[model samples]
Target: MSEKILELKNISKSFSNLIANDGVDFDLKKGEVHALLGENGAGKTTLMNILYGIYKPDAGEIFLEGKKIDISSPRDAIENGIGMIQQHFSLVPSFSVVQNVALGLKELGIIPDLSKVRKRIVELSNRYKINVDPGAKIWQLSAGEQQRVEIIKLLYVKSKIMILDEPTAILTPQEAKGLFETIREMTANGASVIFISHKLKEVLEISDRVTVLRHGKVIGTVETKGSNENDLARMMVGRDVVLKIDKKPSHPSKPILKIENLHVIGDKGIEAVKGVSLEVKGGEILGIAGVEGNGQRELGEAIYGLRNYTGNIFINGSKVRSGDVLERIKNHVAYIPQDRKADALCGGLPVYKNLFIKAFSSPVFSFNPYLFYPEKLRKPAEKLVKEFSISTSSVDQEVKFLSGGNMQKVVLAREIESEPKLIIAVHPTRGLDVGAEEFVYNVLLAQKERGTAILLIAGDLYEIFNLSDRVGVLYEGQIIGYSEPDESHIEEIGLMMAGVKNEDKI
Candidate 1:
């Protein structure tokens, strides 16, 4: 029999009262793609971290090719031929792809000649059918191109076993398809892969076998062909998981939010959001759909009062040209930012404290300077945590300790619970598993039922179709076309996303 390339035996890890990884066993076969499936905070990342030497396993044994091994750090894991590409990519945005790849490797004291590295990168990219411009700055590349850079970085290091965490979270459907093909090509070249994701269809499509984790425990492992999304979701959540986003038929009323001739420059000094006009009605979710980096982020930030924008923005019959961010919020507006780590929550603070960030000065949670009562704040914080199904030990727990999805839940809980007239949710369910996505959808539907106007800016076409009452296709920072959700097709939106106008283009 072929040797198992990697083996993790009875791994367990913890952080305070949270047992991130219970006794779990995992193995990877050479030249095979093994998928790790679970809900958010189901110990998938924790387990991968233990393998990649980011965290020490309290009780476990790691074996490489039937021989026990000790991996003490990220360097150690890399030296042992294991490479990890994280969800939030670690790249110097201003540096070229080759420079970013060669940054840490320069410590080897080798001759600092980038030509050799560039040649090797080209060879690797061709071998794996992955294309990345080594001379392109990280910021100059699209999210898909940046992902290819990450994969190329691993390949440049001669990594035989590659681990990708939530690889498709930010990719469009077409980009995701390309990535799956690349994974197959890697495995074909004798590289074993550990694919970590909560996306069920992609997992079944790419993996040879699947392992489900739940609350730090390994629930089951099954052949990909023998299993289905429903079976895997049940194992991950330990229940009959509902995958559908339920909603009542959209009854859009008068326009509550309107934008006219809006234009904004991206961070790179390019015109990101072009002249665009759109309207969102009361009790409606207007989903902005497109390939990411096509001006979606800039549009959301500008409308949410985070960016300096040249345009007309009207909220509830009032012009919001001169209003500060807080002023906008006070005028019945709430924003859940796209990059949760940098913009949404304060990671160092407790969950309750983070919840009070925007509301701390508001009379609802505080009275005056040096005279604050947490009891009143705690009541609502606790209630929001429960309502959002946040899995934290307590509201007093540091926000950083919560999983990505849970931290997102805290952001949503704070933003949505206050009952704002207009809510801007940007990729609100970005990294969540099936169950959590359903919960968020239900929350949005509930808000719509309350006649709240919602602007959902997301890259996932399926999500936009499923949850939005109407979708506006954003291309080159402008709303190119608008379509009723039920009447539109994914291909139409996709074409518009690439700046192909249906009327102008044959």
Candidate 2:
């Protein structure tokens, strides 16, 4: 057995009334990747935060190299060769990669010469096959490139113990492959890794062992080679989960959503979407496939009246004007945005209030035309909570306090209850567990069977192929190709995603 590089004994942490971690014991050996697998709010992040010194455990002991050690702050952890890359990258948007890495280096002195920093970054990047340009500004990098920068930052700091939180959530399949290769190289170089991910396949692929957490305690730790996806999922959710969606064939009807010559500008003042035309019929899903930032956001926002666009959007054969969100809502067009907290829900409000967002003024929930009959909403909210299997102490609990999966469920329940004619779902299952994903898929398909048109803009090709009846490849702000979803079209779609147009105007 390899030497135990890190160990935690009887770790307990709590926030307010919530028990974040309960007498948790975990260990990691030298040159091995240890994964923490759990549903959101299952205490995986809490344990990692304790190890990273972001939070002090209420009761615990941490040992490094067979000697007890104190990690009181991030500074202490860094000095002790521990580092973490959070889901959100910590680099300054205005700073260069080299400058961000040189922020805390003691060797560089007060003025801090960056030439030495750049050289070391290059050396580490090449050694680990984790590619990044030292001179590039943080805002200019893609999500994958930005993640590589985070890894290089840890390498530059000489961190022997690395903690990565949901590392591949924003990456493409190719980028994830590169990251797995980098993890292998890191282990080969004798570094120990603590990987936290919702994806079970990734846990099995990158880690030597996985420790499952539920509620706030360790369920069990098992060797990766002996376990499968179902085993890990059961350990995480305490049940046998359906890992695949059983999709049914679509029966098309009249167009529920139609876009004509759409040209929408992005936040950067560029024409992100250009001359895009498409239609999604009742009982059909038109999936738009592309690498992130290929105008997917702009197109979705324009149709939902959240962005300025010189285009014509029609729902149920009626024209939807620009900046008329309420009008579109009246027309029964529902939008499931990419960022739930940012665009979809009011975080500070309770789950019940968020659920009543669209129906707040309806006669059933309103009295005297301007005020809500609070009692009228209680039963329906409780019913929605139960039907969605939302894990919450109460419907009166703040929506922000819910887990990611539960939060998404709240959003789904509210939108589906509105009974829209058309639905625009954007990255609906981005950071959910296998169990949560299965539920979302079933809900969307159920809506489809009811003849609701859907526009699915997603980064995962597998997701797109599974739910979509027709697929459109979006490249450089254009629909380069449109085809029926099938395994044989993957190669052509792959080419189109890279901005290559077929000669037949595909």
Instruction: List lDDT for all candidates, in order.
Output: 0.86, 0.88
Q: What is the TM-score of each candidate against the true structure?
A: 0.96, 0.92
Which structure among the candidates has the greatest TM-score?
Answer: 1
lDDT of 2 at 427: 87
Instruction: List RMSD in Å for every model shown.
Output: 1.9, 2.6
Alpha-carbon RMSD, candidate 1: 1.9
lDDT of 1 by residue, 36-55 (tens): 98887888888988999999
The residue-level lDDT of candidate 1 at 449 comes to 85
TM-score of model 1 vs. true structure = 0.96
Best by lDDT: 2
lDDT of 2 at 309: 88
Model 2 has how many clashing residue pairs?
2
